[model samples]
Target: MWWFTQGSCFLPFFLVVWSSTSFILSYLIALFRRDVDVLFPYISDAAANPPESCIFGLMTFVSACAGMATIYSRFKFVEKLSEETRVVNPQLNKTTLVLGILSCIGMCVVATFQETAVTAVHDVGALLFFVSGVLYILLQTVISYQAFPHESSITVCRVRLAVTVIASLAFFPTVICAFFVKQTDLHRVKDSKDYPFHVASAVCEWVVAFSFVCFFLTYIDDFKRFTLRVMTELG
Candidate 1:
């Protein structure tokens, strides 16, 4: 567990799993409590309610940890790439790292500001997370391609690029629909049926989340050696 926590690649893996599972469990509990409407309730809605609020809060906190760790891992990986390509492009690397950190901050903000308590702030956080995520993936995809042109994992990176692209495309439309529906007072009405747009948004949001997680899987190959190490410091 310590290896998983401290390892660069493994940290992201653990975080992805932890965050996803925590949110799912929280959502289920929220559903049972009937605090959130079943059909169109956003991910934030589950975290905002009772009985699952703690779980959701933990998820967000863990997400913040993952985000910061990811920034570190990215910086290290970029350094390695510089050695491989024999080219020093600090500007590009810095940009990718900055965007990654911003995306992480956005996620933390989302977790901190629930849709129920602060709708606008929550929306801003979501926007920051998703938009920065898209930019990070796009930039990293290009960097990975350039950095590892001869490596076999480049193919895998390309595949991840495809997934990120699809997720980004789906994310915008669904989020737009979800927010548009929010403006109609459907979410506020107690007796309203589940709105399709909200449901779609929820589904797409999950896809976006999973897609982003999948993007990080490629890093495992890069950092597998770190996992194999039992200790960073030897006596």
Candidate 2:
């Protein structure tokens, strides 16, 4: 049941991220499917260009933006800490993690306004899915890492290995999709086939996401254990 709870959230979000990556890539691939699609005299078509560009721009913008906001908003710890030394205090660090989660929530506001741009106008639905995908991994990492601090042998040594293995396992799904999505001929599928390089680049994104999930999970588990132990001691 525990594993089920873990996998339920993990698999769904994995599919969500995979679908976005695949959908965008397939669109790009169609852009280059034909034998001479990218000819020099090629006239740019608004119908083909705008919608797809909007699709990508909206999704990627929302995606990367949400990811940035996760990292950036949490950084406000510097402001709240009001100290230049970068000292790590457990209490303050815990507050930082809490604020980080809030930042993830704040991404919703930014996502809602994506439609202010042309590309994102009709595709706002995609942003919702993108936000979930982004948050799942972030929250998953927070769950994983909040437990034990970096100084612990369990976290830095043994437990870290287990989490790394879990992360490495998560990449196969995205990597598999990225593999079939790549093609060298862009002109042929000018409106279809994804770029050969893009397939590889997308894999890098999945890796970061998987690692973030692993770390976040650690944080949550550690904190939960700490809380329970504290309760028992008090009782």
Candidate 3:
């Protein structure tokens, strides 16, 4: 019952499953309607398409839930550390918690304001989600290393730290390149459909999304150790 709280390890797996399924399904639906070129359309384009937009909105809401669950899990981990040492570091924990909450709220905003309905609000929400994601990755990597310094894999925590850094670094330029190309294609190129630059931008966007998802793998091993208890017996 306690593990059923927001911090449940199962939450990450659920987040991953729902987010991935919704994304893939939205893309497929977009393709079915001939509204987007599956190979070249931006992920957001799927959300802009008819019917599939519903799936996209669902994904964003699920993402928001994942973010909140992450905050709770991180808070619990910090509390565990403090309990062991009999000392609390409120500032760092609080900062991480706040960032996670902001990231979740950003996802909600993105969901509420679809790109077709309100481009500016959607863009702002997306930016907030991503910027906070980058910061959260950096902070969590540091926290993971400091929290579990002794993990073996010649240091599993260190490997995960490296991965988080690399993924975020890769995400940074891809997002910028994608945004720049998309903007240029929309305003200047005019023949944006499946154009080389357009395709490149789409690919970059995909890479950024994938890299962010991969960042969560840093917690996979830890998730394995989480305990779950049954609270009620079947009648």
Candidate 4:
């Protein structure tokens, strides 16, 4: 109730907490079940088993929904700010929204189709989610810079830029290492000759995932300044 009255800021905060909890809980469950090795695991590896898979799927679905809502709210907020500041960029705003939507859809796809079950589809979903999500944040950072002094602060813009850059840096290694990792067992990659590559990829995947979470955390402060409303007209 307080969150409803205060502002849409809570959306991003909720997204961060919920998404982080989903991954952590899933990881712990997988570890407890011995479904995955104690070492670094690809996010999908942690959720590929029976019990953890079920929980991970449900939790990730909810997180994806929250992510979509947060992205849409940010899009609308930026659109309003741009109008007020006379720094119109409707095309960019729309493009960001499309990217955000596609990324969220990818998240849903990943949640619905487990990597162990549907490997190809799952990998595609992951690629879609990671690439589109990174591009979305990068575009948002650009927009933040564009709105500087008028609708946003230089500090916030810089922070976003840093997060985007880190995610981007992590993204490349994630893809590259995973490509090189040759392992028969998905759950236990430590025995493989390419174990180092697997470790690098898994670690980088976690970094990119958490970086996406942190990016949403940056939205909390800006979202606090605005509220969303739905209006109805009687015809």
Best by TM-score: 4
lDDT of candidate model 3 versus the reference: 0.66
Each candidate's lDDT (Cα)? 0.73, 0.39, 0.66, 0.89
The residue-level lDDT of candidate 3 at 87 comes to 48
Q: Model 1, 143-213: lDDT tens per residue?
A: 77766653327677778779878878878866686755643332445444535566678778877877777
The root-mean-square deviation over C-alpha atoms between each candidate and the true structure, in angstroms, is 4.3, 12.2, 5.5, 1.7
User: Rank by TM-score, descending?
Assistant: 4, 1, 3, 2
User: Across residues 1-235, which tens digit of lDDT does each residue of candidate 4 receive?
Assistant: 6753357788998899999999999999989988888888899998888798899899999999999999999989888988888675989999999999999999989998998799899999999999999999999998988888776678888889999999999999999989887684657645568989888999999999999999998888888789888899999
Residue-by-residue lDDT tens digits, candidate 2, 158-225: 55556555544544544444446544332434355554434443444345344544444333232222
Candidate ranking under lDDT, highest first, comes to: 4, 1, 3, 2
TM-score of each: 0.82, 0.32, 0.78, 0.95
lDDT of 3 by residue, 1-235 (tens): 6443333556666666666777678888888887766466777777785688877887778777875886677577666666676444657777877887887787788777877688889878877877776677677666665565332243656665676666576556555655546452222344654356566656655665665566665455565454444588789
Q: Which should have the higher TM-score, number 2 or number 3?
A: 3
- Please tell me which model should have the higher lDDT, number 1 or number 4: 4
The alpha-carbon deviation from the true structure for residue 179 of candidate 4, after best TM-score superposition, in angstroms, is 1.4
Off by over 4 Å in 3: 1-7, 86-89, 150-155, 182-197, 224-235
- lDDT at 3 for candidate 1? 50
Question: Model 2 scores what on Cα lDDT?
Answer: 0.39
Q: How close is candidate 2 to the true structure, as a TM-score?
A: 0.32
